[model samples]
Target: MTLHEITYTIKDIQGKGKGLFAARDIKRGECILSEAPLVYVTSNLQEALKSIFVLSKKNAKYFYALCNVHHDISFEFGIMKTNSFPLGQGSTDAAIFRVSSRINHSCDPNVHQSWNPKTKKGHVHASKNIKKGDEILKNYIPILQIQEDRKRLLQENFKFDCRCSACTKPSSERDLIITKVNICTGLVKESAESDPATAIQYVREVLGLLDKIGGICKTSYYYDGYQISAMCSDYSLAQEWANLLLESYQIDE
Candidate 1:
């Protein structure tokens, strides 16, 4: 997707400063935006700073406009630390895209950022149906994490207090969500090999929990559900789940 096709706009989000906001109501599974990075750098900060200075004039201008969350650091390195996301499976490579960087973090985000190595570009997909005025949030940490760990990571790295519903929930309520997430994940791992049938049931539970917990992009779960269904030779169920997974990706295969 290009800038022209993007359905969101950058606007001032209260308490979060600048953020990507949905310009119109967005359907679940819709591609929000996709773009090639302005620059790619090694994990080394010194090299990353050197790399940024050498970017094309236009790219450098755009990069400089991005928010720098770290105030007490070098401006160039600060932006890199503030906005860079991994470009591959390893931490050694990173990429920065103008629009993607503006997306704010939420403990319960409405979007999922995914990297497509084949195209060498990254794309954000709506995790749940988003309203026109809603901010297009991206979770900066793992979704399965408990509230304390999530907030601690954000505080240490981004230097902000997360006030999202999931983060602010009382321990009694928060623990339930954490417990359910762990149960679903553990069930999938344990049953996946020994009991594929049970794995399918566990995957269903996972998808349901994900939807309840604001979707955390649940796309991965649907894919696993499809695979498990196929493994059970339940072609009909496999096709159904495959269709849902495709809808979640909004990809034309």
Candidate 2:
């Protein structure tokens, strides 16, 4: 939809504004859409503003559809600030993807978005199975942090309260997950030498927790699995984690 062919269709979500909805049942790790960015800004507020004015009329229409998180700035700047994603982790350039930008945010997002600098294209992949007609989502804030920080960050930037299951989990369950995550990080670290078997189990536990918390974007644990597995000379486990890691990032052959 929206000038590109995707498995999702554009629909107006009542309180959240526009959102992407699955047009069919989408399996986990499936690529929802892949396309070159509509525009690239050198990841600065000033450059983004200038680009908006130069965008062709056709492109401007799509830009206008994006949400304005910062009302204090020019409309164009707000759109860029709110909608643009990084070229890659810690990159200075920002990318605006047409179809993927329409995807709304959920703490427990069903979809994960990744940018490939080589091809200069963005890919949206299903992190979990999405039933037909379900609204597709992407995380606007880092999901790895404690829920409290995640909520504050979302409110500060996106100007919304996150009611996702992760944020609203019962106090006891929330604490347990956070505690497990912290312990597992050390376990994954030690698995490289001290105990590969324990590391695999720890990473699996962490990944399971991540899925329960609706976080599939951070695949570092998969690399944890692959590294530990390979160190232990477990090729089968290493390959399984490698495949999962690639799919999580929407990397294809």
Measured by lDDT, the strongest candidate is 1
Residue-level lDDT of model 2, residues 192-231, one tens digit each, is 5886787788888898886665555457888888888888
Let me know the TM-score candidate 1 reaches against the reference structure. Answer: 0.85
The alpha-carbon lDDT assigned to residue 63 of candidate 1 equals 94
Candidate 1 lDDT by residue in tens digits, 153-243: 9899999988877877675665576678678878887887679888988887877767667656466778888888788788998999888
Q: What is the TM-score of each candidate against the true structure?
A: 0.85, 0.85
List where candidate 2 sits over 4 angstroms from the true fold.
Answer: 1-6, 169-171, 190-198, 211-218, 232-237, 247-253
Error of 1 at 14 (Å): 5.2
User: Distance from true position, residue 106, model 2, in Å?
Assistant: 0.8
Candidate 1 residues lying further than 4 Å off, grouped into runs, are: 1-6, 13-15, 44-47, 71-73, 88-91, 169-171, 251-253
